[model samples]
Target: MTELNLELTKEIELLRLVTVGSVDDGKSTLIGRLLVDTKGAFEDQLLAVRKKKGETKIASAAEIDLAMLTDGLSAEREQGITIDVAYRYFATPKRKFIMADCPGHEQYTRNMVTGASTASAAIILIDARNGVMPQTKRHTHILSLLGMPHLIVAINKMDMVDHDQATFERIRQDITDYCAMQGIKDLICIPMSALNGDMVAVRGENMPWYDGPTLLETFESLPVLGQLDEQAFRFPVQLVNRPQTADLPDYRGFMGTIASGTVKVGDKVMVLPTGKSSTVKEIVMFDGNLDEAFAPQSVTITLTDEIDISRGDMLVRGDSMLEPQKEITANVCWIGDEPLEPRKKYWMKHTTNTLKAMVTDIDFKTDIHSLEHEQSDQLAMNEIGQIQLKLLKPIYADTYANNRATGSFILIDGFTNNTVGAGMII
Candidate 1:
């Protein structure tokens, strides 16, 4: 990690992308190819892959299964399907990237949602031969519903189609038309063969008719990060770092990750729920004092006037403080074996705040393939629905589409303490 200079301008760009497709659409292979072709893989792993390339019956000659990079679990290797979101990091001279390889199985949609929730771009894979399937429609609708700003439609396995221009064109049009219906206008299409490394990280001569930049080239060109809204300064306290002793005996500090915006010394801020006011006395990081701190950075803060503050509390610029609400309407993706029952109590974890909440009412269930909503009483596995939640105590939050950190949360079962649902605030 590069150190943030106190006097220099910080203009770094970070890109978060998610890859999605049905099983065997080569999602993992594509990521593997990108990493390996870009020299991101370590020497030992590359050598081991080369040695094991043609030893198995399922393995084809010159066909390196890139899934090996992320399928670290023995069961995943044996099953040959991604069950969770595996993250990998890579960088080029122009930009840095964090890629999330989301699973394609219908049963693992929750994991896919978890992976793609924070992504700025999504790569939706389509088998050239299969063209468009139900899962393709499902994921496309998901990307749109989530309001992802950008998308890449990868027509994979072009080798199976003999790299035919007509076939690629047909599939591209199919996806284009479908995405158009879902209001996804910013979409890019590319034809590539993940196994042979054609038009993935490096452009290949196999598809001369296709005249777009290779996948990696396009990734390098896409605008990486977005600026956090400077209009508001919001920070949620995560911990109170007070080690009471001589040097810092009277220290009363609130520490947490910046949920959004920026904070600096002497800024007038308001502590939520309690509605107390204070001025920023000091901004602190692990190394030393900071003149200012921005979104996503973890830091400790001291107020000019000490006021009662604790975990789950929010701090914001006086004029930007959001009103706390007891009831909320949120979009939830049901992920557990049991259906989401009405009036059932569950744990809601939003940023640093955790509260007991109950299912107040079911609004409607969305058809992932159709992007249509139908009134429903309950949400089943892999179902996306809008529902109302009544919390035991008021919690500060924002719409998921507006703020990623404050708008998202997980639903956990109290008895088992297992995450049963993933929710995005409406």
Candidate 2:
């Protein structure tokens, strides 16, 4: 490729986003509309959707089951509700997007968390007629707690409310007030009818009084947060490469993705849980060697000194003051079918490290309805609470607020080996 083509490819940034809201709030329809309007959907896919039986139509246009575009499962279509998270990919001239259509039912909140966990921004749909419902508040609270950088409250189904300005303003105020209470920082409210395409990909004439960027415009313009190179260096060693071949007998390289920050040749680094210091000798890749590498990039590095590093060991800056701790308190969202009880053991997987851990105590459970803290001894399914954990071995970490890559973990049930909970270090 030419230099200009390479630069253009680098400039086309990818945005990871999630759609969340109460049941029947048009989450699926909005995504389908985006795909259709952006020309992201294939002709065969549109043809398949047209064959599905549904009374729903976008605005007053020809009959098209837009929700069927994302609701791929038979169960979801039969029940007329989303159950599992459905992912869709689309692109415009300015940007590319990977959107997750999350379930809205309260029982499937865990699925919503799974979708929102890695998203940079979220589009929360609120039915204009219902305003802010309980499920909407619950999803908002979860998003805020997860430290979502951007939130777009799409007031959907404006056509059903006669495109009334008063109704839009009232609902917008309610969402604004609630988000403030949750301590959300960046937020924007847009009045849109996903079914009619107003304020979505195009600004239909239905709500000309409300002037703002269309949903696609806002998505293309929102500042992308969490630049990994700006944070402290964190490289969790996933493997130690050693080829005993005669041509390259002494080759020893530490291989892993840069979880956060940057690393370059000759940079002094330290191995965690061992405190062995070394200097980077080479940054190796399949194409060739690089002078430096940053977060989210998987590469191999041969250090100047070999200090017996292995999997689960993390490499940091030589002068780093990060300490490994066996005990930690974290905010956890329980997702398992069984209730989480104190003194129960589970496997805790943080970054590339996994070890036995036990829940020591449940600090308090959060009431999603009122945003109140209530004392509790155990956490049930879809419940959020603060809890204490003791690990079998120490691991280097940072607070989730400071660095999500190294601070978040998942708990696996010992018997079933299923991921039962997700936690963020406090």
Best candidate (score: TM-score): 2
lDDT of 2 by residue, 1-426 (tens): 112355565678888999987548877678778887877787666766774455333332224566677778898789887678888898777788888878777565697789998789999999999999888888899998888889999999999999999999999999999899989978899999888889988999999898889999998998664676889999999999998899889899999999889999999999888888989999999999999999889999899986899999999997655887899999999999998999999999999999999999999999878879999988999999999999999978999888988989999999999999999998
Candidate 1 residue pairs in backbone clash: none
Please estimate how well model 2 matches the true structure, expressed as its whole-model Cα lDDT: 0.86
Candidate 1 regions with alpha-carbon error over 4 angstroms: 1-14, 47-61, 160-170, 208-211, 229-231
Report the CA-based lDDT of candidate 1 relative to the real structure. Answer: 0.82
- Estimate TM-scores for all models: 0.88, 0.92
TM-score of 1: 0.88
Off by over 4 Å in 2: 1-11, 51-62
Quote the positional error of residue 240 for candidate 1 in Å.
1.5
Error of 1 at 216 (Å): 1.3
